[model samples]
Target: MSVNSFLGVFAKSPIKPMIQHMDEVNRCAEALKQFFKAVYANDWDAAETARASVVEYEQKADELKRKIRLNLPGGLFMPVERTDLLELVSQQDRIANKAKDISGLMTGRQLQIPEPLTEAFDAYLIRCLDATEKAKETIGEFDDLLETGFKGRERDLVNNFIAELDAIEADTDVLQVQLRQDLRKIETELNPVDVMFLYQIIDWVGDLADLSERVGARFELMLARV
Candidate 1:
């Protein structure tokens, strides 16, 4: 069941379809960026528009995942284990799900961004997006890993990519903490319920980065078997 060459079956490679799914995930991340920026500007309408994009991308990603899973070849041999690959896809899918959740919660509640928390929230969102971007890049290396049979210089390169993702996640963690502190500054000024939900949104943002980190960690585990 071993593949002769990944390029030979590029059309059928689960990796290829998975990459497309990751692309949609990245799009969700971008939409989040715009959504938050609009919120910062106090442009609720624009933020709602941006959130629509997130919802759309997330839905598309889910659709793609279903298609890939349905068409996934049984008993096919690859550079990485099939089960692990499926797990990786699930992990990546969680990121987009988190993005959608964050957007849905914010837009549904029409949560107003506090002026004092704007700066920190913006930075925090950017850091979370960075982690997701790095995760996408790490996933992009799958073709190379398959071509090289997950060995030699190819393995080293992916290792470095995973390490960079880890760094991004760590930086995002710091941003999350700072964002919470900033939220504290304006807690009294905001309605009690608003403050509670804002804190929840910040927590969800952190969850997004944490999921991205998990994607990279799972990738490392897959590489270990190689």
Candidate 2:
């Protein structure tokens, strides 16, 4: 039996998942800021606090996902589009989680960080997070963008944000290579697993930014047709 039919009286979901997704994305922004602060200050406590925030935000996003899946009454709304939105928002939350994971993983571990490179890469990380947050806020304009042409600050901001992400991605590639080379010279050993995990974290961050771009592209298409 269909869950909605089992529950009976299918009606519009009172919860605004779009708004929830916006809030979740904002939470990630704050978490990213905290993550950088923690690293700069070399304080694991701050990093832990940031991680806790990620969990709370993701929990709320997950709740919204469940609500949308069960109560959306397909065909009443843009079913396929709505499903994709939910998935994209979930991806953003996971991106935030990955940042938290990296912070925690490095926490308390004695790492030989080159002072200059450390500062530079940390700044790049913050820029990436900022771009992601802006793109996320753009996604919240689904209703307005669908009705009106992509003529709003949010849409413009997302475009610029994507450009900035492109630059950061390039810089990150350079920094990653530099850091790995430096480490190889100083450290006697490097674990493949740790290297793999670090790669995954960076890739996930990029994925978040990419998902936001996809949302913006879809919003533009929807605007053109609507």
Candidate 3:
């Protein structure tokens, strides 16, 4: 087949919707950061405002997904390098969904972030969002990420982000186990139920980080030529 016969990166396909979806994801990350700040301050009003931003970003992502599935474009430029465009898009969508999930948990739960763990969560969140935002920006510049012959500094950022996230998840796991064991004395007051609930929420937050790391990994796989 001629080189021109292959799919165009900018062609009208699910790629556009994917880009919009990731933008919404990035927005939610920012909203969550602000939400964490508000919660740390114990400012209910600020928290509510930040939560609204999450809702808005969630709605936009939902709308974009709907439009993509309902209105399939005829002339699409998908990744000729990676045939798993649908799978990739779905995985990217999950990152945004998980972000919304974390935000939803914040809104519904009466979470009390421990003073020491607060900094850790903040660091984890910043790293996850940094990885996610980098992935999204790279997507917008799709050509560079999907080249058959081209390769350069992109891998440097992606490699570092992925490595950092792996470490973050490990750190979260260690902190959670240590915290739970140390709280054994107070188990009488809060009981295992309350402790479990708190731990589960923290675990879910780590999952969001995991999803972001997966996004970066997916990009790497898609970029690697067969």
Q: What digit string (tens of lDDT, one per residue) describes model 3 on residues 1-226?
A: 1222212423434455566667777786667888889878877778878888877887776666555554445444544433345556666677767767766676677565666556765766675566567657755545444442334665555556556656655665566566555555455566466567666666666666667667666766765642
| Tens-digit lDDT track of model 2 for 96-182 | 555555555555352223454466556556655655665565565554543444557755654565565555555555655665555
lDDT at position 41, candidate 2 = 68
The TM-score of predicted model 1 comes to: 0.92
What C-alpha lDDT, on a 0 to 100 scale, does residue 97 get in candidate 3?
Answer: 77
Cα distance off (Å), candidate 3, residue 96: 1.9
Ranking of all predicted structures according to TM-score, beginning with the best and ending with the worst: 1, 3, 2
The segments of candidate 2 whose C-alpha lies over 4 angstroms from its true place after superposition are 1-16, 77-80, 108-114, 149-211, 214-226
Worst 10 residues of 3 by lDDT: 1-10
Q: What is the lDDT of candidate 3?
A: 0.62
Q: What tens digits encode model 1's per-residue C-alpha lDDT throughout 26-144?
A: 89877898898887787889988999999999998888777667666767777667788788889989999999988888888888778877777888888888889988988888887
Give each model a TM-score. Answer: 0.92, 0.65, 0.72
Q: What are the candidates' C-alpha RMSDs?
A: 4.0, 5.7, 5.9
Q: lDDT: which candidate is best? A: 1
Candidate 1 vs candidate 2, lDDT winner: 1
